[model samples]
Target chain A: MSSSSQINKRRTKPAEVRIDELMSAAQTLFLEKGVEATTISEIIARAGVAKGTFYHYFESKQHIIEALKKQYIEFFIGVLDNAVRQCAADDWVSQFKVWIATNVQTYLETYPVHDIVFGVHHHERKNSEKNMMLEQLLQILVGGEQAGIWSLGQARLTALLIYCGVHGVADEAIANQLENTADFSEQIALQYLKMLGHGELNK
Target chain B: MSSSSQINKRRTKPAEVRIDELMSAAQTLFLEKGVEATTISEIIARAGVAKGTFYHYFESKQHIIEALKKQYIEFFIGVLDNAVRQCAADDWVSQFKVWIATNVQTYLETYPVHDIVFGVHHHERKNSEKNMMLEQLLQILVGGEQAGIWSLGQARLTALLIYCGVHGVADEAIANQLENTADFSEQIALQYLKMLGHGELNK
Candidate 1:
């Protein structure tokens, strides 16, 4: 109700905007200088935020890295989810193809950020991001199985195989600086469809 | 030779034996305390060697890690190679089965060392070890294709998928601590065989 309090409210940005600014600043610095060489001071300066504001949001460089990781996963899953939803609910084949194609394309576009966020956790044996991604792929696999589009002896195992297979090949594509990801993604989808006992679909 | 030279030669171990002793010591300490917590002094002490002797072989902790990594890959490839050789040369299917099963089993048994040595390079976008392992798997794939056991549209891509898929799943198995790896290994081999367009082999 005070005049000073009213002025502070007008100056302060919303919490979400503030958080996004900090993460964006950190990501840009991480990409440019490598995460190890980047500093909290550099991030806050880039965001044009007070030192207190940076500390209030993130405890350390490592904490912001975790937040960035969570943000990256949400964005990644959202992109894939939106792409998959474009297919009809019962059109599992199309749904899966879109998922594969979108996954490869999105990851290829975003892997520099992905590497920065996920670099330290690369050797972590247990990962929630991996699980979340697997869960997304699993829904498609289970749906196809229920529709009798394909049969699976082990749905989770098969999902793991396809999910991991797709991710692995994408890493190869990225390493090779592959340019024709559209064609490459299609080939991957078809090959995996064959693995799922749907080679007839390809023919 | 002089008397001191004769005594020094008699007192010293062979180069291979000394290198193995140093590497084994470093591996044990790395596994026990983690690579970061371990020190060169500890490695030399564990090997019952003097500081000079340690530096005579390795310049630093990182240097020894590099040596251990090389040693690990050679041992890993050697084990897989030996297992594949046990199968009939013309039996591409069995060669592949053994390769997958042995890859899973050996990686399961030795993953601690594998993680220790390869952990630092986890985020490296390009890797020689990956290529080397892929080359080993590619041989079976190419053999199978030549024999008409199965066909591939992209042999390297297929090989990358299978190699990374098997590795990723094995990592999952390790995280879950699944005990029946023999059955688990068989299942993986069958699934990948299916991926290679030979699912009928399972029946």
Candidate 2:
């Protein structure tokens, strides 16, 4: 093939790779400046993509922000899921501890990006992202209950309390710039386990 | 006295009353038409005060917003404090329970105003308002610990968990428009009490 044809072929990259490049570029600019300051032209320029390609994937800055939020939630949930899965299938308590630890650790490490994507919707009460995480916790709570490790008076309410409580405590940890999170996470897990009626573990 | 003098005398209201009138007018407008849409001129019009009076107390809309936030926090803290005070002095568990219940009840009743004042600053990491509320909770936790009502592995951390947890769950309650908050609050208090090592009460 001629050199011109080869150059054209390189420009026609896979759609997923193009979309990832655009999102990564937008995220970098959003961090450097802010969502309001960063524009589509800057994102396209940073990603080395054509203007048409950027428009093809995202209609506007707000559209891209929603896409980023969805992507961030998926990654956050995946990290928590993976951490819980490492424990023995029936080891519900261990599964929970790992979930809490991973959540705090991941959130602390990734909160800057998280703040970028989620800052606007932080006060949204009925958020789907929140429900998605709550569902994950509910599964664990129900599992532990099923195995006779613990019992719940109201599983969904209990899940909301735990989910929101852990998240709130993690926000405090971030504020305090807490060190020694392993011990911190352990203490949190212990307290929550006690709340779940697994006080026998305290012995 | 002349007609002009009579009108002047009417304008010379107490500073506290004038300020309260201004805040109330602004709050009414904020709820009716969001903060961004409400103007200082409209506020003065609603308060039946001159533009000079509005500017004398507040430099700009943003200044008034900050003032409103401080006022809101003070009122919120006062409400929680009053509810807790109604319990027996040494009844630490009842105090804590009342604190949680009142927090849910008051927040549900006044959250529209709360949202108007606090919406912008919701994500502030090290907010003084949050610290003030947290301090109130720490006092109860410390009191309970001293009385041997319960124990704490990490007093401040435990306080953060409970305070943030209760606040988060209350936000959920607001979202759900929960009607039976008395029972909801009791369940929350029981779970948190268990976390505080008062599991004996569960029997």
Candidate 3:
């Protein structure tokens, strides 16, 4: 490879690689000892990186975690957005199935955002920015509801259930409760949404 | 009345008074300094009780906090249960109004629980023995679906939506965004639920 090619690979790879590595460390520590018990020094140590290198990427400990959370919510919203687009091309049942596939794919991809994202507690008043997105989420959901393509009865409630099912996957994934014998997380989430949207068992 | 009679009156007050006082102290410090920074000493100091006195009523920090959480969740579930019970005597609209009333009452009364229960970084994941009663909630909702007493669409989704309205109240109340000036919180919740259940914009 040329010298420029070598530099390009090294530069692009480290940032993404370091982020994943740091996130894995945080996830491990956060699980073993809740978020309160884990610290920045421990995270850097586990990632085998200098403290300054960690700081180069993150503003604060909670900052990185919050970033992780924001990324997760954003990704799931993308999944939903994609589902909405897919549903536009088909009917409700088929739409729900595509949604399930998208949800599972997004979750199983291991983007290293799960630790502080979907399962994040919403009670802290400091998480104002994140909570703002939820309100906007309401706006988007309401728009979808009015569109007749979505078939929303209670937009807010439907959002919560759908979020809960997604959150359930994260919670289970974190605690490692997902049984290895079956890969039903995606199907279960689909069933949950189908139950909410129509409540009809398989025809 | 004599001093003795006044002392007797004080003595006869409910046990929850002391608990409420302790929880108030813990909640304030927990919000200010977080669960890790807030200590038993701080809680007792704020409550103006002896350290031993604190120990007399509670086992440890986690125990007391769990007690507070349990009481809060129970109080919430109790309100929902009572409302659902009362629903048997009324039309579906009135029943939904009653249910929403319970949601508003619980959210208003336990503002701290709303603070602690949501948005916090740390959540203790113990097996929830208390959630068993939720089956009762499911039964009541499913029964309504079977009776065609609901909107003739997805009853499961309807239940989820109504619950979301309840959950949304916490976030709304916490953010001080609930401007139920023309409508009371209960009334707003009821209207939201009615809209979800029947897709109605009317009384």
Candidate 4:
């Protein structure tokens, strides 16, 4: 083996690390200049990788965007998952409250990335990616139903209302420059809980 | 007076009629073939207007789209206004229900145009047009609160929740090909009414 080849091997990163670095760099650029203004060459330069390395993982700018989308979804869901874990296993009401609060807080803090990933596809008549978030939210609704905390005649629709309401209201809060996410979250949770026939929780 | 000048006077239409013709043609083409596929030439030909006539009214395809967006907002709000008129002034509950129902129904019927105009601009951080819809909804919410029909602590947030939830779920309904919009509308209204501390309305 040549001496230079050995040096290059020592500098090489794991495939997962390389992909993450590329995605991080792309995300920064997308947030800074937006997707339309960003390019593959800039992404490679920021990641300190060869042009071939980018093509090895991502076919084009859109592929990196797809990867960023998946990562955003996972990151969003993970925040809710961790928040829900803080409650007792059978305490569905607390779990639901935590889910709503964490959802608003996380979305408020990370909306630039959220906008970058979700901006272009609002016109799609149907979106399978939305269903992933819906399915996660459905688990909470179903759990509350089974626990006798709430009775849901149409759980999927109910989930859609709550999930969308949470997302939509956060956007409104951001638009209005809302100061206290915690206070706002509590208010939103009370209203949703009221819809679930748990108005007493507002007390 | 020349014979050609007199002949042209009879052939030329008033500005209002010409603008309407162009918009009608654009809406039809946008619905049938999507905004991306439709062309200005096709719009002019369909409207039976000369190229100069088209240019006189709109600067470009995007200009026409902006005009159509204004028309669509007016049409949408007009439907809700008419629906609310069916209820008496003091009957805010019924007014609210009609607002929600008509919003869902009209959106379901007219989503193609909605997607066409709104699809491209969803990423914008602040949209005054969306705020207009929210403002209309806030009147129902605040009116209900003032009339002792319901008590709302955060009326604007509630409006945001209702507006966003309604829009998001309608998108879901269209995606799922929901057949009976009436049943879905009633179910949605019940949940929202309950959130307004009107749980007895569900019975």
* Candidate number of the best TM-score: 1
Position B23, candidate 2: lDDT: 90
lDDT of 1: 0.88
lDDT of 4 by residue, A1-203 (tens): 67875676688876778899999999999989989999999999999999999999999888889899899999888888888998998988888889988988898899999888888788665766678878877898899888778778788888889988998888877777777899889998988888887754334
Q: Write the per-residue lDDT of candidate 2 for residues B80-141, one digit (tens) a residue.
A: 99999999999999999999899899998998988888887656778888789889998999
TM-score of each: 0.92, 0.92, 0.62, 0.89
Candidate 3: the clashing residue pairs are: A69-A117, A121-B119, A122-B119, A123-B118, A123-B119, A124-B119
Report the C-alpha displacement of residue B68, candidate 4, in angstroms. 0.4
lDDT by residue for model 1 over B1-203, one digit each (tens)? 57775677677776668889999999999999999999888999999988998888889998999999998899999999999999999999999989998999899999999988888876676888888999999999999988888788899889888888899899999999877788887888887788787645434
- Rate residue A86 of model 4 by lDDT: 88
lDDT of 4 by residue, B35-139 (tens): 999999999999998999999889999999999999999999988998999999999888888898899999989888888887788856578777888899899
* Residue lDDT tens for model 3, B55-148: 8789888877777677667777777777767765535555555555666666666666656643343433323522333354446555555555
Alpha-carbon runs more than 4 Å astray in model 4: A1-11, A200-203, B1-11, B200-203
RMSD of 4: 4.6
Instruction: Say which prediction, candidate 1 or candidate 2, comes out ahead on TM-score.
Output: 1
Arranged by lDDT with the best first, the candidates are: 1, 2, 4, 3
Runs in model 3 deviating more than 4 A are A1-51, A74-93, A104-121, A124-203, B1-38, B45-49, B80-93, B117-136, B142-148, B151-165, B168-173, B181-203
- Whole-model lDDT values for every prediction: 0.88, 0.87, 0.57, 0.86
User: DockQ, per-model, please?
Assistant: 0.69, 0.62, 0.20, 0.64
Worst 10 residues of 2 chain B by lDDT: B194-203
The model with the greater TM-score, 1 or 3, is: 1
Q: Which stretches of candidate 1 lie over 4 Å from their true place?
A: A1-11, A200-203, B1-11, B200-203
